[model samples]
Target: MRRTTTGPRDLPPLGVQQAFRLPETADVVLPEGLRVVCLRSPSAPMIELVLRIPFLCATENDGATAEVLATTLLRGALGRGEEDVDTELARAGCSLGAVRRSDRIEISGSGPSAALETLVGVLADVLTGASHAGTEVDRARRRLAERLPLLRARPSTLAAEALRVHCRGDSPALRLIPAEAAVASVTADGVRALHRAAVVPAGAQLVLVGDLDPERTVALLAARLREWRSRRPVGTVVPRAPEHWQRPVRLVDRPGSVQSLIRLVSPAPARTDPRFAALSLANVVFGGSFSSRLLSNVRERGGYAYWAGSRFDDILEAMVIAVNADTATDTTVSAVAEIRAELRSMATKPVTDDELRVAGNYLLGASALAMSSQVGLATAVSTTIGFGLPPQWLESFSDEVRSVTGRQVRELAEEMFASATFTGVVLGDARLLAGPLGEHLDMVLA
Candidate 1:
């Protein structure tokens, strides 16, 4: 097949088209109370497995223990050592990892469709018979200790950590990096206890997407995962994020830094709310994309920063809108002022028809792109399951984006962004930033 040699200008004009079709989905609840979500993508030759366990740590120490457990769970299981497990998975063309998040622990893996049974068996073994060896636990703990300091050295990471602490207020959920002392104190027994308490089948979701029969897959999963059970009762309800957004500006003093990292955070609407579409569109207009007002004003026109953008997190109880920028220390105040002004403008003025159309097209195009891959589809399904949304929501998303009007965008802006309560953080050299930042914000050293 000869490839087309058309230049960019010689190609046909770009236009929006309905390009995505929702995959066939089935939701099943096993007798052991494990929820299974299956999506069949016959065109893909690979199968993806995503398991979401509702794992919550009650304290910072517990959070440390959970992190250690997540790292060491796959090291050995069912009479196999770490290298043995790796060799088996490699032979089956599979890979596995587990990540501990604020609300849950996600274990994800993928392999050839023909090896689905093998993948499931391996997953079951790890879940039920993981050997939390003392040596492996100690190694994981040492690795974490070595990584924490390097992560803290980055200005952006420092800014995010400060903001999370400001907003969440010492909650274990916000403890992304446990203290070195806490990690050092973690033991193999503690890791085992955490695994037993948090890695249960109850309130867990197993999502499978690829070329397979949903019914057959469900039956196989039921049989394979039957032995994995927990006597401890797990709560299905997701906890609410803090509602308080009002706070004085926090300055994490990263001395000798030439650039300042600015982070602005506020609360927004949840994904299930009727206003979510409107907020999403409004965000695209504000700072969610390259053509957004924030980028246009701060980076493009003023030439104040290298990049500026905003993002929205759709959690269970609440949503979060965050704007991030890295600018020279001298221009930090100006960049911040421009961001605030654009936010205020979005809330007060009505968006133009062209802006609305473009933002809607961007959202739809991005969604279509995301669903074009097996991993992407699996992730989308997992997110929907986490939000407690129906399967049809993914199918109807494009229509919902198309239905958002300028008036709805403006209204959502007014409600969510007009009186936006901002908790801002700046990580930079104190000597360079203290004067300008202090003029506009109540600077506090962190």
Candidate 2:
């Protein structure tokens, strides 16, 4: 039978809830100070591994060097050429790659269960004997130097960078993008030095989930990482969020542009907070999802924008809620007003029971889907531990979401969004925006 529904609230109930549980896991610390978390999920004969190396540095200027280092880390290591490394991984039925994040360098890999030992050996080799050869470093530098300028010119990138600079001073730990000049100046030797200093296992974590024995996996890691030693832990520094911006909203001029980018951000509670789930639900009701009030108001109904939504982002020691929209240049002012109005509505008006139920179910379903695969399970475990949460935190998080009441969502929303907490940048034509946006928001020309 074809079912008709007016809204998420009208959808059928999710039937009896099954208790969420995680597989048995073994957590161990190697003598070399490396933390390994292993889980035995025999659903498939494959294993996924994630290694997080804290890559904090003293100054934002080091970001360029860090990028180059990550690019060349696995290019050629331990006297093995790039092709040789590829052939070995292929023979082991393994695939490996890396990405440089603001605070860490994450190396992820997966392979058949039988190849766990071989995969670990390749990871160890990359960690200790990465060549950072001049050719590779130079090639990476040129690529970054060419790409960064284009990235900087992007409207979305401009808004994000502006938000970071406004909320948190430009520090190495919070800076998201490196300057083009910095990328151009990175050298082979510099990349190598940064690698030696920041890629140690002392303060790193490794997560493995698949068809593997926890004890044996731990033993393998201990044996393989025996030589991966360091005297000092990876340096970490948490940047503080400023209480206020010089202006509540900063406007950047993109002359003759046909569209405008609006980004709003505010501090959010840590994941460990008891009320975090309520706030998370409130975010969904307001703007985090397609059916969210912010999107329904601006894009679906008002036709002020084509893209509009909100999300939560995690930083080193904190979290933030951000709302973003890309709208026609002429609708920029109306879009901002609608966004602020939705925020006000979310705070002042108590969310309906239907709205609360819909958001809660979405959160629960997303959590379930996230843990349904080896890669997903591994990522979930990695993220949980990375946030300083217990390995079983996922088991209880669903309950937290289910228990949140509409009243609590309203109160939390009022506390979080019913103020001038948001500070952001709007990229549009100043000639068309200055007069109207100035009256609607406390905006300054940038």
- On TM-score, the leading prediction is 2
- Per-residue CA lDDT of candidate 2, range 1-446, in tens? 89876666755757755657989889998887788999999999999999998777576558888888888888989899899889999999998898898778999999999999889999999998899899999899898888887887788877776766666766767677787777777889888778877888877889999999999999998888888877554455667756554356888888998999998877888888999989989988888777889889999999999899999876455588888999999899999999989888876777888999889877788788889898999999898888878788898888888888878898898988864777778988998999999998988888
Expressed as tens digits, the lDDT of each residue in 1-446 for candidate 1 is 99876777565766856846677777898877789988899777899989998765566687788888889989999889999888889999998999888678889999999999989988999999999899999999988888888877767666766777666665666666787778888999989877877788887899999998888999999999988987674333334567566767788788888899988777876777777888888889888889998899999999988899999863335568888899998888898788878878876677888999888888888888887888988898888887888667887766777777888888888777753487768888888887777777656767
Report the error of model 1 at residue 98, Å: 1.6
Task: List pairs with backbone clashes in candidate 2.
Answer: none
Models 1 onward score TM values of 0.92, 0.93
Each model's lDDT: 0.82, 0.85
lDDT, candidate 1, equals 0.82
> At residue 245, what lDDT does model 1 achieve?
66
The RMSD of every model to the true structure, in order and in angstroms, is 3.1, 3.1
Task: Quote the lDDT for 198 in model 2.
Answer: 82
